[model samples]
Target chain A: MSDKHMSSQFDADLNLVSSKVLEMGGLVEAQITRAMHALNDFDIEIADQVIAAEETLNTMEITIDEECSNIIARRQPAARDLRLLLAISKTITNLERAGDEADKIAKRVKRLAEDGSSRTVNIAEIKLSGEMAATILRRALDAFARLDTVAAAQIVRDDKAIDEEFRAFVRKLVTYMMEDPRTISAGLEYLFIAKAIERIGDHAKNIAEFIIYIVKGTDVRHKSRDALEREALS
Target chain B: MSDKHMSSQFDADLNLVSSKVLEMGGLVEAQITRAMHALNDFDIEIADQVIAAEETLNTMEITIDEECSNIIARRQPAARDLRLLLAISKTITNLERAGDEADKIAKRVKRLAEDGSSRTVNIAEIKLSGEMAATILRRALDAFARLDTVAAAQIVRDDKAIDEEFRAFVRKLVTYMMEDPRTISAGLEYLFIAKAIERIGDHAKNIAEFIIYIVKGTDVRHKSRDALEREALS
Candidate 1:
C-alpha cells in the first residue's frame, strides 16, 4: 500500500475507536438514568435491568482497550494521534467506573425496597443531583466528540456544584437521622446513593479533563479550578 | 545502532519506568499509613504532612505517565512491551487515586479534630480495616513488581475481607447512632473515613488486576473470584 493509503487507514481506525467510545458513553448515561428512576419509584425491574447491564459495560471497556492496544501496535502512531489513543484508553476506564456507580445505586435501591420501610427521609436533593450528574456526563461526552475544550472546561467547573449539593444533602440526612432514630438506616442508604451520584459527576469531570489534555497536550488533572480553566482555554 | 543494542536500550527504558512506579508506590503506601495514624490519634501535624505530600504524588503521576507515552512514541514497542507500557499508564492512575484517598482521610481527620467531640463510638474495626487495606496495597505492589499472578489473585481475594469489615463497622455505627443521637455527627465522619479506606483497598485490587492482565494477557477486572483465580493460576 502507498504511504497515503496507510495513513488514511489509520485515521479510519481511530475514527472507529472514537465512535465505539461514544456508543459506550451513551449506554453509561442510560444506566445512570434508569438507576435513578428505580431509586425514585422503587421499581425493581428497572433496577434489575441496570444490574444486568453492568456485565455488558465491563465487556465493552475491555474490548475497546484491546482495540486501542492493537491499533498502537499496528500503526505505531506518534504525537497527537498517540495522545488521543492514550486519552481514549483512560476515558473508557472512567466510563466503565461510572457504569459501576450506576450499578451500585441500583443494588442499594433494591436493598431499600426489600427492607419495606416507608421512605421517611426526603431524597429530593439526591434525585436532583442524580439528574445533574447525568446531564454533566452527557455534556462531557458531547465535548469529547467535538473536542471542545471550552465546553470541557465548563464541565469541570460545573462539577463543583454537584459536590456542594452532595455536602448539603449529607448535612440534611444527618439532621434527620439525629432527630428521628428510626430513619438512621434509611438515611445512610440515601447517603450512599447520593455519594454514587457524586462519583458519577466526578467521572464525567474526568472525561472532560481528558478532552483538555488531548487537545492542548496539557494535563489538567489534580490542578486547581483556576489553573485547569486557564490551561484548557489557553 | 544495531538491532540488539536498540533492543537493550528499550529494555533499560522499561526498567526505569517500572522502578519509578515502585518508588511512587512506596510513597503512596506511606501516605496511607500516616493518614491512618493521624486519624487514630487526631494528630494535626501528621495530617498536615499527608495533605502536603499530595502535590508531590500528583506531579509524580503526571511525570510517569508522560514517560510512558514518550517510550511508546520512540520505541514503537510491539506485543508484550506495548502492553506493559499501557498497563504502567493505568497502574499509575490507580496509585495516584490511592494517594487521593489518603489525602481524604487526612482532611476528615482534621475536621474531626476541630470538632473536639469525644470519640464516643469505638472505631477499632475501622482501624483494623485501614491496616488491612494498607497491607494488601503493599502486597499488590509487590505482586506487580514480580509479575506474580498468584500473589495478585490472592490480593483480589483478600480485598473481600476489608469489604466485610466495612459492612460490619457500618452496621455497628448505625446502631450506635440510633442509641445516642449525640454521636451521630462524629459517627458520620468516621463513616466517610471508613469509606475512604475501602476505596483504597479497591484501588489496590485494581492494580493487582492490571498485573494479572499484563502477565496473562487476560482482563480479570469485573470477573468472579473463581474465574480470576483459575486464569491467574492457569
Candidate 2:
C-alpha cells in the first residue's frame, strides 16, 4: 500500500504488457510468413497448418488485449504511458487482420488444390505480392517493438508497391482468363489469393500507424480534416 | 488565460475538425455512387464524368489529412477525443482509397468506350457492387461521426457481405474469361476494378473500428487477436 511499492508494481505491470504485445507480434509475423509460403508452394500441408495456427494467434490477440485493457483501467495510465497501451491495443487488430488475410490465403490454397489445376503463372507475380506482404509484416512489427515512428512511417510506403504489384497481377490474370476461358476459374482463384495477400500489406500499414500514434502521441486525423477545411475555404 | 477562453477555443476547434470530416465523407459517398452509376448505365458519359471528378476527391484526401494532424497537435486530445481525431485521419485514407477504386470504375468505362464493347454481364454486377460499397461507406462514416459502437460493429458484417459479393463477381468474370481468351485482358481489367472496390470495403471496416476505439476506449486489436488466439489454442 506504500507509494513506493505501488509505483514499482505499476512499472512491472507496464513491462509485462509490452512484453506480451511483442510476443503476440512475433506470432503474427510467423503466421503471415507461413501463409505466404502456402500461397507460393500451394502446399496444403502448410496451408492446413496455417489455417490451424490462426486459432492460437486469435487467442493471443484476446489475452493480450484484455491484459492491456485491465491495466489501463486499473492503473489509469496517462500521457505517454497511456498512449503506449492504446497503441498496443490498436496494433493487435492489425496483427489479427493480417492473420485473417492469411487465412484467406490458406483458403485459396485449399481451393487451388481442390481445383486440380497444374498450370502456373509467372509465380514471380505471386512471389512479388507475397514478398511485399512479408516485408510489411516484418517492418511493422519491428517498428512497433522499438517504438520507432520513423520506421513505421517508412513501412506504410511499402504498401504502395505491393498494391501496384497486385494490381498488375490481377490485370494479367484477367488477360489469361480472356485468352482461355478454361483457365479463368483456376486463374481467378489465384487472383483471389493475391488479393488477400495485398490486404495483409494494408493491415500491416495500419499496424505501423500505431507506432506513430504511440511515440508522437499525436492523432493522424488532422491530416484528413485539413484537407476538408481547405475545400470549404476554397 | 481565463477558463472561458480555453473552453470556447476547444469548442471552436472541435467544430472545425468534425465539420471537415463530414465534408470529406459526403464527397466520398457521392463519388462512389457516381462510379456505380457509370457502371450500371454502361454510360460512358457518366463514367467520363466520374473520371473528371476524381481530382476533387483526391485533393480532399490530402487536405483533410493535414487538417487532422494540425488539430491533433494543437488540441492534444486524449481518450475519446484522441480516438475521434485519429479516426478522422484514418477515415480520409479510406475515403481516398474508395475514391481510387471509384476512379478505376471510371477508367474502365473509358476503356469500354475506346474498345467499343457491349455488355458482357449486364449492369447487375456493377450495380450490386456499387450499392454495397455506397452502403458500407455511409455506415462506416456515420459510425465514426456518431461514435456508435453498435453501428460500427454492424459495418464489419456488411464488409463480409461485400467480400462475398466480390467473390461471386470474380467467379463470373472468370467464367467470361474462360469462354474467350481474347476477352481475358478486358475481363481482367474489370475484375481488377472490382477488387479495388472490395478493398474500399475493407477500409470502411477499418473506419468502423476507429468508431469503436473512440466509444469503448478499448483497443479493438484484441477483438481480432483473440480470434486468432482461440484458433491457435483450439
Candidate 3:
C-alpha cells in the first residue's frame, strides 16, 4: 500500500474504534439513568434491563480491546497514535466499571423493590446525584470523543458535586437508621446504592483523566482537580 | 548500537520496570496487612502510617507509568513487547487503586479507633479476609512478574473466598445494627472497611486478568473463575 493509503486506512480503523467506544459509552450512560429510575420508582423491569445489558457492556469492552491490540500489532503506531490507543483501552475499562456500578445499583434496587422497601425513604437526593453522575459521564464521553481536554477537566470538577451529594445521602440515611432500628435494613440498601453512584462518578473522573492524557500526553491521574484543570487548559 | 545490544537494552529496561512494580506491590500488600492490624488492635500509629504511605504509592505509579511510556516512545516495541507495556500500564493503575482502598480502610480504622469502637466487634473474620486479599495480591504480582498464567488463575479462584467472607461480615453487621440501633455508627464503619477489603480483592483479580492477557493475549475478564481456570490451564 502507498504511504497515503496506509495512513488513511489507519485513520479509518481508528474511527471505527472510536465509534465503538462511543456506543459503549452511550449504553453505560443509559444504564445509569435506568438504574436510578428503577430505584426511584421501584421498576423491576428497568432493573432487569440494566442487569441484562451488563453482558453487552462486557462484550463491547472485549471487542474494543481486541481492536486496539490488533491496531498496535498491525500498524505499529507510534507517539500520538499509540497514545490514543492506550487512552481508548484505559477509558473503556473505566466505562465498563461504571457499567458494573450501574448493575450493582440495579441489583440492589431490585432487592429493595422485591422487599417492598424501595419507596420507604426519601430518595430524592440519591436520584439527583445519580442524574448528575450520568450527566457527567455523558459529558466525559463527549470530551473523549472530541479530544477536548478542557471539557474533560470540567467533568472532573463536576464529580465533586456528585460526591457531595453522596455524602449528604449517607448522612441522611445514617440519621434515619439511628432514629429507627426498623429502618436499618432499608437504610443499608440505600447506603450501598448511594455508594455505587459515588463510584460511578469516580469512573467518570477516570475517563476524564484518560481524555486529558490522550490530548496532552500527560498522566493527569492522582492529581487534584485544580491541578488537572490548570494542566489541561495550559 | 547493534540490534543485539538494543534488544538487551530493552530487556534491561523491562526488568527494571518489573522490579519497580513488584516493589509497589509489596508496599501495597503491607498496607493491607497493617490496615487490618490497625483495625484489629485499634492501632492509630499503624493507621497513620498507611495513610502517609499513600503518597509514595501514587509516586510509584507515576514512575512506572512514565517508564512504560518512555520505553514505548523510544523503542517502539511491537507485538509481545508492546503487549507487556500495555499490561504493565494497566496493572499499575489497579495496584494504585488497591493502595487507595487500603488507605481508605486505614482512615476508617483510625476514626473507629478514636471513637473506641474498633473493639466492639470480634473482627476476626474481617482480619482473615484482609489477609487473604493481601495474599492474592502478592500472588498476582508474582504471576505478572513471572508470566505465570496458572498462578494468576488460582488467584482468581482465591478471591471467591474473600467475597464470601465479605458477605458474612455484611450479614453479621446488619444483624448487629438491627438488634441495637446504638451500634449503627460503628457498624457502618465496619461495613465500609469490609467493603474496601472486598474491593482490594477485586483489584487483585483484575491484576490477575491482566497477567493472563499478557501471557495468552486473551481478555479473560468478566468470565467465571471456572472459565478462567480452564483457559489458564489450557
lDDT of 2 by residue, B1-234 (tens): 012334677767767767777787788788788877776666788887777887786677657655655555556555555556655755676677778788887888677767766455444564677688788889887766666667777777678788888878876766665565666666665776677788788888877766666666654643663442233223
Best by TM-score: 1
Angstrom error of the Cα, residue B102, model 2: value is 2.4
Candidate 2, CAPRI quality class derived from DockQ: acceptable
Per-residue lDDT for B171 in model 2? 68
- Per-prediction DockQ, in order? 0.88, 0.23, 0.67
Off by over 4 Å in 3: A1-6, B1-6
What is the lDDT for A172 in model 1? 96
Worst 10 residues of 1 chain A by lDDT: A1-10
Greater-TM-score candidate between 1 and 2: 1
**Could you give me the TM-score of model 3 versus the true structure?**
0.96
Predicted structure 2, TM vs. truth:
0.72
Count of backbone collisions within predicted model 3:
0
Q: Write the per-residue lDDT of candidate 1 for residues A122-152, one digit (tens) a residue.
A: 9989999999999999999999999999999
Q: Judged by lDDT, which candidate is best?
A: 1
